[model samples]
Target: MSCFEVVDPLFGAYVLGNAPVKQIATGFDWVEGPVWFGDAGCLLFSDIPNNRILRWSPSAGISIFREPSNFANGNTRDKQGRLLTCEHGTRRVTRTELDGSVTVIADGYGGRRLNSPNDVVVKSDGSIWFSDPHYGIMTDYEGFRAEQELPCHVYRVDPSGEIKAVLTDFAGPNGLAFSPDETRLYVADTGRMFGSDPQHIRVFDVALGGRLSGGEVFCTISPGCADGFRVDSEGNLWSSAADGVHCIAPDGHLMGKILVPELVSNLCFGGRAKHQLFIAATTSIYGITLNRRGAQTP
Candidate 1:
């Protein structure tokens, strides 16, 4: 069966279905947050329900990166190469230092405990962005169920140690990413999973003072919703949808899709030249070669 459904000619340039989809590993409860470490030649991802982080490399295959990872949900590397992780069980974002020490990045705002940091991304400006949703706290499967004190919001943590609630108008803020040029921000609002409304990716303009404006629905994923995504160098978005991965153009058009056997939760660009698309699906990690390169961090 074909893996790609090209809706536009531009999508054809990126979808190379001739390259077979490879399964790197399996047997996880639920996998998400795939980040490629070129320097280490390994990929790290979260098995949220398992409450651990797993590592996979071409030479070593699969091993435990971190056991009892506080039910970590999402992770990304900073420009300085530190691992920034969002912990659902702890309801905080943490940084793993080069020396292997973990530091707390953000856990609470204004003395009120955060709901749960879901997905995280580092901006070129040295600011950290993350989504706060109650998914982790809503069930005992992923994390401890507790009373939520903060509303669902996306936060920006600056280098100077200031945390700002950038966006607070969503019922559930799930995944977040910046455009290739860092001029735009795309965040997934997955409220539709619990209700009947708000199930699209919202795009916003990144302003001069680290503020956001122009909150508009960029596109809607049918048969599912966008959970996490990354942008190609050309500004095309590869989002994790229920069916598989949906490729959305910069202009909010459904370009194409890569159908995985399992539902995808998140993805990132990896490999030597950064064209390899690593997907975190329900129970396995899948990858395929793509024609476009992912927009790398500075």
Candidate 2:
């Protein structure tokens, strides 16, 4: 079967090839958090079960970026291009400095430890946002199992070192991303991982000081959950699915699906122009060049 499924006529415009899902690397125990570093000309992502982070590029191929990554799950670059990571084992969020040092960003709240930071994004104002779920603490393969100290919620950490629980109505919040203009925030509820709940994405209005409002259902994925995704410059959400990558329009319409051979775990836009879409599926990494640029495009 063909790898591309163009539901809407416009969907074909974004896909550059009939079978563009090329396997760039393999031999992983479940890959996630594919983020591009244009300045470095490589892509960095997590191997959750392996407890390491891997780097891939045309020149260098695949190599160990960090072993014992604290069972890192998600990653994104700050405004200054520093790496922001969500560590499951450590049960905290951290930042990789330019000088090769690690800075602990957020590890706890109210004097109690966080469950496990699943995904993270950095706003233009330097505020850090992430989804906290209990997945990391529920399994020892990805992270050490531990008792839950907090309910699942989304958080925002400001430059002043204050953490605020912005949303608390999810069973298990998984992935999150911001619109290109940063006017909207999109979060996914992968309830299947924790309990029997709908697998859908929610949208919210970004208020002043990075506050969130107007929580509403954005889209629903059938037969699978939205694990991780990224927004394009035009606001389309490219989300991971059981089949592959599903492209949903800003209006919450399912526009297309990139039919990857394996289940897609997460994806990100990278390359020098930030137009290449990288897919981190179950045990391998797939990538393709796209006509669209990511929200973090330089």
lDDT score, candidate 2: 0.90
Off by over 4 Å in 1: none
* TM-scores of all predicted structures: 0.98, 0.97
Ten residues in a row with the worst lDDT in model 2?
191-200
The residue pairs in collision within model 2 are none
Per residue, candidate 1 scores C-alpha lDDT tens digits across 221-271 of: 987789999999999899999899999999999998998999899999999
Q: Tens digits of per-residue lDDT for model 2 on 1-298?
A: 5688899999989888743679999999999988888888999999999999999989989999999899999999898889999999999999999999999999998899999999999888989999999999997988999999999899999999899999999989899998988999999999735478877899999988987788799998765789999999899999999999999999999999988888898999987788888999999999888888888633
Q: For candidate 2, what is the TM-score?
A: 0.97
- lDDT, model 1: 0.92
